[model samples]
Target: MAGTHGIHVHGDVEGSQVVVGDHNVVINAALGSSVSVRSEGPPPTRRRTRPAGRALPDRAPQLLGRDRELAALERWLGQGYPVQVYGPPGTGKSVLLRRYAADAATSGRDVVYLPAAGVPAEDLVQELFHACYETENYKPEPARVRRLMGSVRALLVIDDFQGSTAELAELMDAAPGCDVLLATAERHTWDEGRALRLEGLQEEPALALFGEELRRPLRDEEYEAARRLVTAVRGHPLTLVQAAADTTFEVDEDARVTGLANGLSDAASVLLRLLDALSPLPLSAKLLPILAGGVDKAAITELTSLALIGSSGTGYRTTGRVAHLVAERTGPARDAAKLAPALTAWAAATTATRHDIAAEAPVVCHVLAAAAHARDHAAVCALARTTAPALARSLRWGAWHQVLDLGAAAARALGSAADEAYFRQEEEVRKRALGVVALATAGGALAAGGVIGHIAGTAGHGGAAAGKTGFAAAASNPAAITAAVAALVVGGVFAGLATAGDGQPRARPTPSGQVTSLAATGTRPPDPISTAPRPLTRPPSPSRTSPRPPTKATAPPSPTLITSSPPTDPGQGPVSCPLAGGTLTLGAPAGGEATDDYAWQAFKECDDERTLTVDKTDPDHAAFGVTPTSCPKTAHPGQYIPASGPCVYTVRFHPPQSAEPGTQYQAHVIMRDDWGRLSMKVSVYGTVSAASTAGPSSTGPVVTGAACVCSPVRMPRRTQRF
Candidate 1:
């Protein structure tokens, strides 16, 4: 069967006409008339209705809040200052624009309004041209647009704008003769216009809005409940109205979320989970695809329409209420798997303190935080390992500490011996960096203000180490100890522990062959290799002008050894198990002795002479024997093998007994070196499927967890290869 279709090239077609027909192109042609042609395809998808540029009512919709903003806007527009009003979704940007446009129309001025969002730039220009000229059809030439706009005294309202500043600037430039107003979910500071950031309603007005929507005056008790509802939704007007209509202003959060979810596309629904997971950090439309695992941009647009998320000056944020809803609906496993790769990429990217880089802080923080919350240890450690150097270089001490803390927690949670040790090494590096600065400043006899340590401790970790010998001790009596140490170091006096407030010398022996003090105490040094942190004391304040170096006859001094205790509770099973293909999962173990590979090396090049040794006496070591009983050997017992440089260790799981159908097992790996540093325990999980009735090799979804730490290992500089 041959199919024929009709197509129309009608010059007389009005504004944006659609021609639809199939297989029967019987062209109806008449002189000085139209010829209809048909085309064949599926039915046209439903198109979004254009927003009506309707006139405002004589009595405007009860705008209970926004009085101040409304007054300010009127004054600005009256004074002829072009204004751009922006806020998060459902904050009533479009409603305000409509009211303003209606007011302009009532004043007898020509009014041109266009819903600019979801429309192309060229199409927007054309719409503007048509509105300005009072014509349905026109070419969108910039010169013609300017000419049409200049000939009329008009108010131009471009609502729901989404684009760069330059695009808005271009629109403003074209409509030179009119007062232009833009409403958007983004922030733009136009050179020729003012930007007004809209926030939620005030308390009284928010309550008033609720009452008005409910069509009744509230009693005192109802008013209190309404106030609670308003506060819960952060005074967003739309939410209050919906609550008033549906729940009588009592505020049903679940109902509210479901209402918002109504009419949302599937992609938008999935994005809600990602946005909720990242609610802890600032989000932007630009980062939507990256964070949502490459969702289409149209889905983001739909999310905006649904008002599931809102925007600030530079980025987006899901409201606390919406975030809660999303959190309840989303699974931790889904979030971890989706966000792990994106976070890894984000941490690895080179960034700066410049404007562009600064804008990315929210996304970065959100990824790390979400991964941590999801108990995605592999993702957290991956981010930490990659971003450590950059964080150090940028001096983002607080962020660096956050990474370290999260990484350490994840390592501990995973029960990966090597992973835990890796985090400890990183922590040591951080401690050294912080301690060196404090110690060097004190030694230099410089003015060590409390702000340095105080701010670092406050911002980094709530003064977590304040009680001990590291930053906390330094911050506690910075003046006496730091000042005295600086005086001594300035006088070329090197090693000695500080004195306590009670005047007792709190000390520990220094390492071998290292001079503790210029003066020798003749006392035998303590054990040189205890990794435990020892208490430090404050030193006596020295006279400013009378600094003297200590002689060789002084008593032996204790060198400070700052360290923290290894975790005791290896941590409950990771918050969520990695799905197949995510980090921390090796494919289903082949029987009881399955081997799992890792992505990063487990070695660190350090100055310590202690050799890496498997403590066979340790239960973990005995359970998962090291492969080949030596370094540089491959294909030994379990999946893990140690390489020459720092490389990820593979683990081989040896279940006590296997071959059981419909059972799950945990593979635990714990390794340690002779220096007392313990590796994070790595746990890989797998399940034995029910025996298939068919073939012996056939199995159900073999549960798999990749125990690999997905980070590239970088060897430390200046290390001697063994």
Candidate 2:
């Protein structure tokens, strides 16, 4: 029975769950929860959760090609649902979450944005306390945390969450009036809340972002090359940015890979080279130790955090880009040599559990395809046969056939006609036994992931072999169930996670065409990242060990939040800080043909500064485009600017003759610095405060965006993604 504290279990094999809370429950599932373990300690203490990493960035990535996404986020926000923005690494999840948090903060809702790529939950909680109460040392006692959470509305934007989903829900429930919007790169079924999977930017947006990378529009002659380049890399933002510098703009995947891998650390370079052998298939983190060999876990995590590897804790997959770069090396340390044994060892280990053997089934076949290139055909042949049981039980009749076909070819290569005929006959026997496709459609693929294994497990569970050979009995975690790697493989969630033998993203089931998301219950397109199989240093372990379903936090579960805005005068909202450097800012200038010289001190320390110069002032509305005086874009011609600078610039604001008395004119500045770095944008607007009832004067637009509606953080005309 589910109670006030949210400690309940939703047993699928049993009767209905009695949810005695605010959430609506569904039958046969915990629709709102998973296996929850209540804290067994005494009354909560005032123990502070230690904070980690840096605070939220002042700016957000440009929101490129996300109008529909913006509308979806706002609509979901209004309805009060937990929002999940998911996509592969580098799809700009962090940027979106930061924007959401900044907006909420501007609207007077307490906001805490945490970028959790490699951060632990405890560290995040520490960040929460420090951000919320504006105190770093205070221990967050349950009741105290509860008061702040319930007394006011709040939002927690956890970007790239790698912690426990249940734990996250618990923290939210504990904090009564708080809501959460988490972004992740892994794939999971979320039965509740709203899930938005951010894909690669569409064609136009891709080109637009590429131009932005170039900091100029594509030339007419260069347009076709850019188009072919964009299409060649499938509109992946980061790839485009890296490729922009390659003037030749080759229309080849290998060329794009070479370009993207231009500058990488030696450790990263080594890991990528080794991991390339595992391409086209995402290997589970559990197998990292074997695959990565002696590669340090820190390097793996660093790469993961940088999106050069897996999307954090979701296992690792090699991108074709890594393949080309690694291919250039004649390494003394050969990672490819280690590939065969690792696959074989992992395959052998699965035999003990007989669960999700198909997890690595497709991967085995794909690896075999690279036998000649891999310099290890003999082992690959063995690998295919070794995982045969997994292939059949997981309903990979096609893979099973491929395995036999590979074996027959191996025999033929050895000039053994008898062995080849024997292999062919065995293939026919298997085909006859498994018959045609065991299932079709995405849903069927997921279900068939464990069809045969489940049957065997059931037999060992309730039949004559109860508690013996079945997966559940053999599994170390008694309550856990293996999710279908085969199912995902079939539906294209992992279609190109592993590349074909030739080192390119391969559409599985059929090694052709551009990879796409599951048309049904599926995953994202072919976006790959990886690290050596490194040991997990944080919670929210991979789905293999604990496959928790999606659900809302149960009731009365208070944890803690860090920051909130103090009371503000009515109509005088909190002011936002200036947007981060290197983007455009909008200003709605207001005033009549007034030539007012407002002090530009507000933007003194807005961004990284050394020496500032005005690049260009193109007003959306007019010259100095803002309605009134323009926000300062640059300091007086020449001066060294420091981190905290009193960089000042005098600008003439030619407000249109029809300017209004209290209109807020928006000004976008492309602030260029002498340093070899991208320019920063600060949206500055002039504001003439009106009397607040009987008050003398009121707080108005400043260097910040909030009171300024907060620069760069706004829904924005558009943002960059990558």
Best by TM-score: 2
Q: Tell how far residue 126 is off in model 2, in angstroms.
A: 5.2
**How do all models score by TM-score?**
0.32, 0.35
User: Pick by lDDT: which candidate is best?
Assistant: 1
* Tens digit per residue, CA lDDT, model 2, 295-379: 4777666455434455322466543344435435524444443466677777777343323454445456656666634545466
lDDT, model 2, position 70: 67
Candidate 1 lDDT (Cα, 0 to 1): 0.43
**RMSD to the native, candidate 1?**
31.6
Predicted structure 1, TM vs. truth: 0.32
lDDT of 1 at 527: 24
Q: Which stretches of candidate 1 lie over 4 Å from their true place?
A: 1-59, 134-137, 248-722
Model 2 has an lDDT value of 0.42
